[model samples]
Target chain A: MLVIARHTLRETVRKRLLLAVVVLTALFLLLYGVGSELLARQIRERMLTNVDTALPLAASMLTLMGFYITSFLGALLAIFVSMGSVAAELETGTILTLAARPIRRWEIVLGKWLGLATLIAVYLIVASLGILALTRWATQYTPPSPVPATALLILEALVILSLGMLGSALFSTLTSGAVVFMLHATGWIGGLVEALGSVFDSQAMVTAGILSSMLVPSDALWKGASFYLQPVTVILAQNASPLANPFVSATPIATSMLLYSGLYLVACLLLTVRRFAHQDL
Target chain B: MTVAIETVDLCKQYGRRLAVDRVSLQVESGEVFGFLGANGAGKTTFVKMLLGLVHPTSGVAHLLGRPIQDPRSRLPVGYQPEQFRLPEWMTGTETLELYGQLSGASRQDLRVEIPRALERVGLGGRGNEGVRAYSKGMQQRLALAQALIARPKLVLLDEPTSALDPVGRRDIRDLIRALRDERVTVFLNSHLLAEVELVCDRVAILHEGSVVREGRLQDLLKTSTQLRVVVDAVTPAVVEAVRPFAHAVVPNGRSLDIELLSPDHVPAVTRALHDAGAQIWEVRPQQMSLEDVFIGIVRPRENG
Candidate 1:
């Protein structure tokens, strides 16, 4: 299993797509690096030299914006990397030799899943932490709860990875990736509907949104992360700002939502194992 | 004699498609067993079923005394799948190393075997080249080498020579023969009848997912008992005289092709032709080609 996991990691990490993504990510970080330096210099000058200037919530808004961009990219990268993990092997008949070896089918699934999961974890930690640290460096302000918010964001990416792998079991690699992305987009739409339903106090509208979230908990995880990243005062400001609506939630995600995310992960993983075990190559 | 591979009423289905019907077969230890079939005849499906790549819809397969699904059962088994694909990023040596790890070979064991396996398949010193750089025939050789990496007791090769040149095909045939000499049971699945004829000790012909014929190659082809004779200065009298002793006679380019009732009739036919003032040039029993036997078994029943 370790051999398979290591080999799987080697296979995915060596792809040109990952290299392109890494290059893009580096460019993104460089731009942020320069922006953060300028913002930090500006904050120091304003806070020390100038007084009586009403400090706008630039840090808070940037925090939300940074996390949103990084998190969305992270989620998409996770899906892109994992979309063909097993499906490509099955399609190209590359899995035959491995499947015929002394290893069991479930080991292949679990090993591959472990490699992708570990990849997403490392990526989430480095990119998310780097983004947050840069934000803090720029504005000298942090989120209300950094650790929980980061954990939820990581979970959101993992949820997408899990669904991508699950889709790979039933469809071709590209189709599975597309399906996971569609489901993710649907969840975002659902989260928006639920947020609107809350403001209007419409149970029917809320139920419709909640049903989609139940199918895939990507939006729930994001909403949960947003709840921790923004304080109540910032939420009030966000409610008034139409531009900030995508990243803002009226209330913290319910604790039950976390349970659903956990269950969704296990369910997708288990189904992948069972389906791949019997699937023809 | 121990059975290295045995299947009892094995079947595989794809929706309404009966890919592999209730096919039963047994291959004894050290036998080079050939599996022949037409397109979509379920040869690959059966092989996959035995290797646990495809779940059996019913029945059972045993390899080296354990059920097919049991991983331990595959410890002594090596497989070269049809249209084999290896990770293109890996060198041939790395590919072997990976399979070595999967086969649970110790470092010492791999150390002793890797170079020898590569050399055996005629890919010596080219192990460092990435598979993406290998030509199709070279890649095929490397696939065979990986199957030999663990020194398995049974090697299942599907279309092992499908991508090879004439020399490469001969190399694979010689390799199969060498495996047979080493007492390794080989399940050779191929549509290449000539190759099968050269190496197989036993064969099973599959038609429409069923084993239409199974027996020792010699026994299955024994009934082809035809003697071809070449004669010089032969006339209609020589042909007519030879016809009495031969069950059937065909004349082409100064040679009379005689279908002998048995081996005993060969001497008599030669004597009759010689007595007719025909100078006998050459005479030999016509061994049935694997292609003929295969066509006989796999062609539609109405044609037969």
Candidate 2:
């Protein structure tokens, strides 16, 4: 299993996709830092009516954007990287050699999962945290919850990767990506629905959002992260505001959803293994 | 003698289509066994079932004296899939190293065996070159090297010479013979009748997901009853003159295939062609080749 995992990581790193992702990420991070620095200078020079609200809100907004960018790109990366994990081997006939070996099919699944999981972990720590560090260097303020919020973002990306693995087992690589993207999109749209529900104080709308989250808890995880990143005082003040807020969850994610998300990831991985184990090459 | 492969009513199906129907056969240890079949004849599926890449729907198969259900049964087996692809970015050496690791080769075994394995397949000094730079035949050889690197007791090769040039084909044939000489059991699955006829001691012809014929090469060829007669000019009159003695005559260009009622018709056939003043280039008793036997079996099923 370690052998397969090591080789998987080596092959993945050699992909042109990773090179492009890394370069684009670095460039985006640089530009964002520069933009933040300019905003910090302007904020300091200008007179602010309420520094408390202004300072944390500015920092939280930047941190929130950073989280969104990293999470979105990380999801794309996971889908693209893992979509071909099993299907491509089955398609190109390369899996024949490995499948003929004395290794179990589940071992192949576990090895590939571990390899991609490790890659996603590194990507999150570097790309997501790098953005946070850049925002901090430019502005003295930071989000209230940095570590846990990033952890939530990482879990969200993993959920996508696990789903991608299941799709790879169930469909072609292109179809898997397309299908997993739909699942990811459903989560995003569900988050919006929940955010609207929170703003409108509608139980039915929140119920709809909860239904979608049960199917894929990616939105729930993001909401949990947002609960940490958003300013409490601002959210409290916005409660009486008339306009709609995208999403401002005052409470963290339900412990049940978190537990279910963990199970969803495991279920995807297990289903992939079970499906491929008895499948014809 | 020990049995290298054994199958009893082994079957595989894809939806409504039966890819490998209930088929059973036994191959003795250290024998070069050819599995002859046309495209979609379930030859590949049978091999996969033997290797455990495809689960058998029913019946049983044993490899290296162990049931195919056990993963360890495949540990000492080597397989090269038809038209396999190596990671294009990996150098040949890296490819071998990776396969070695996956196959559970120790570091010491790899250090000593990889260079020698590369040389065995005629890619001795080219291991550093990336697979992207290698030609199709070279890549095929690399796949073969990977299969043989571990020196297994059994090797299953699927269309081992399909993409090779004439010289390359000869090299692979020689390699197969060498494996035979080394007492390695070979399950050679191929549609290349000529190549199989050259190397295999025994063969099985499969069609429509069933093993239609299986036996020693010479024995199967001997079962063909049609006699071939080559003449310089098989004109209409020459065909007419021999039609009386021949049960069925199929004249194509300079060759005439005559179905014989009895072996005694050879003299009458020659006399009839001579009476018509046709020059007979060759009139010896025609023996069945592998191709003739294969078509004889597959033609009926294909027509049905």
Choose the strongest candidate by DockQ.
Answer: 1
Give each prediction's root-mean-square deviation over alpha carbons. Answer: 3.8, 4.8
* lDDT for each residue of candidate 1 in A192-236, tens digit (9 for 90 to 100): 887788767779979989998997788888877877777667788
Candidate 1: TM-score of chain A is 0.89
Model 2: lDDT of residue B75: 80
Pick by lDDT: which candidate is best? Answer: 2
TM-score of chain B for predicted candidate 1: 0.83
Q: Which stretches of candidate 1 lie over 4 Å from their true place?
A: A40-56, A231-246, B228-284, B299-304
The collision pairs in model 2 are none
lDDT of 1 at B245: 68
**lDDT, model 2:** 0.86
Docking class of 1: medium
Span of 10 residues, lowest total lDDT, candidate 1 chain A? A49-58
Stretches off by above 4 angstroms in model 2 are A48-53, A230-244, B223-285, B300-304
How far is A222's C-alpha from truth in model 2 (Å)? 1.2
Residue B248 lDDT in candidate 1: 83
